[model samples]
Target: MPFAGTSPHEDYTAAVERVAGQALGVLMDAGGAVVPAGFAVADLHAAQTRDPDADLPGLRVLGSDALAPHVLRGTPVPSDRAEAAARAFAVFPPDAVGASPDTAWIVTWRDWATARTLTRCGLALDVPAPGDGAQVADATSWQTWSVRMAQLSSLALPGLDGPIHAAAREGAEALSRGLVRSMLRRDYRTAARIARWIAWVAADGVAVPLDLAPLLRHVRVFGGGSTRTVLDTRIAQHVTGLEGS
Candidate 1:
């Protein structure tokens, strides 16, 4: 039984809660009965397996000391109906910070937030229609980006409110649209280039230092913001090579 409401906001919120709960349940079931032995339930998602390619951006995008769900979930709230619903769930206390085997779990949570924001703000995401495998890939990429965005949101920054998280949302949404095309078309060079720029932007915002070479090694091209090693590597590289450019 679910609460019935005529308000689009209410209905959207309920849907987000339902879907996020299901996703969480699936993750927990997959991770074994309890949260992974050594991990905090908040940090690591147990259900989905980690994709080496899923590290589109690293932890640098997150601020230090974590944002704590109590502080972030409800504040600087999204105006979009759907995005609000997802953000509401992403900041659930339990999922705030901990060991997550699959970064995709973090991403999925964040994607929920993005959807919620878009709805709340009454704005469109500026993404392409589902086509050429992009729809599925966009969905998957957002899911992972959402999780990482949540983690980044957890960190504390002065006077900025949730700008980092908002940026993450925008970035994730952007990546969702065309990331796979770069790879499927064998556009490794373009992939690397995009990764380098986005990665730098992500790291600069969060102030974390990362190296790109190791992250991009063997990574030809990829789509999806989270599960693409080359993308993550490029981002990390930008973090390290700030002055090199």
Candidate 2:
């Protein structure tokens, strides 16, 4: 049903929101408090008024977007959260039928994130290794490829480094074009993801051709407050020395 490893649009959006909220807290990076994630399932379930003991269909589809923040933070991860993240993946593996590159990349990063989160705590999660041919759709047209890369912006974390990170660094020019094009087209979410990539690559000392200050300023001033978009921008802000230094 639903082509496997995917959820309905409304439920998926809610699931992303659920994790983005946790991601925001970690992104805030307050002066000194230890930002521990809550117990496995969050208040979203309570908000749903469902049977807490039963796994909700939507929640099962959360993937590793739910754990990327904790994985990237390099902080003490609550055991339950790691286990919860593992369970979500167990229910919806990355190599499901007909999964898009966007969904596939996020899950690839999730496998990496869940493993890292648990490993940091001296634990292990049985995550499947991402297939070798994952997310390499094509790159002949950088503009279109940028859109594909934008979906994997969750990979923009400082702690997460791999070929994808290197790709963002090497493809800075194309990413910039994608960023500018998205801005012109008023696709703020895409713009936000590209901005996160710019900031991430910039952190690696790659001279991002775009002036992030004004771009970030515009995103803040004009980008409508979608939780997911806000989370991306906030991570960009944190990485670029705009906030949470």
Candidate 3:
């Protein structure tokens, strides 16, 4: 059941889960092109949402996921859903997101992902050159660096390439280290997310340092609890050409 909009945190959490669950549902079906259950296709843009601030993130997430099938193959997102995604793009400009240093790279990454998705949808927006913050640019340790890459799993999509994606590729060993460490400690969520980044790197024709197939399978088995977790593994599968494996 969905939570009442009790607080900003809860509202945002609910939106995240809702979008992840509905998108997951759509991905599960062979012929499921219909809009996910929560909102009518016309009402999907955040202008009609109860808490636009809280819900905009959800819309952005769904919109990003909506582009996957298209990016993976030639399947286009349905038109009404594409319109909803375009509207969400207009509202959530990345610069206004007020992210701290730890999260600024993620926002930048997501903005890049949004731009890629929208352009494919023929609803392109004007995006400025992304600025790299100190947190990502000056990281000294693999520990902090790996965690940041894991957090960026949402942007680990096909054709979502940029400076950070390049950085992830260059730092492939650190990311693999993190994934191995997380899996060793049984932190499936963190492991799954890091694995997603590694998969993204591998998909870009870069050589992966770790044996990816079993790692992805292990994470999918143990980490497939939350909707977002499952979503991460699903995208990782597609990115690695292991979708049916």
lDDT values for all models: 0.34, 0.64, 0.67
Residue-wise lDDT of candidate 3 within 138-212, one digit each (tens)? Answer: 777898889887867767887676677878888888999988998888888788788888888888777778888
Which portions of model 3 show Cα errors greater than 4 Å? 1-8, 30-56, 61-63, 95-98, 132-137, 242-245
**Candidate 3: which pairs clash?**
none
Q: Tell me each candidate's RMSD, in Å, in order.
A: 18.8, 6.3, 5.3
Q: Which ten residues in a row have the lowest lDDT in candidate 3?
A: 34-43
In every candidate, how many clashes are there?
44, 0, 0
User: Could you tell which candidate, 1 or 2, scores higher by TM-score?
Assistant: 2
lDDT of 2 by residue, 69-183 (tens): 5555656656665565556556666575246755655566645655654566676777666554235445678888788778677667666677777778888999999999999
lDDT tens digits, residues 1-245, model 1?
Answer: 12233464443333333333322233223332222122222222321224221111121112111111111223332233234333333343223434365443443343433433343335444322212222223435543443333243322122222444345435643542333445455555444443443454454454323334543553533233222222234333434354443
Q: Give the Å error, residue 2, model 1.
A: 73
TM per candidate: 0.21, 0.73, 0.76
Please give the ranking of all candidate structures by TM-score, highest first, separated by commas. 3, 2, 1
Clashing pairs in 2: none
lDDT of candidate model 2 versus the reference = 0.64
Candidate 2, residue 228: Cα displacement in angstroms equals 1.1
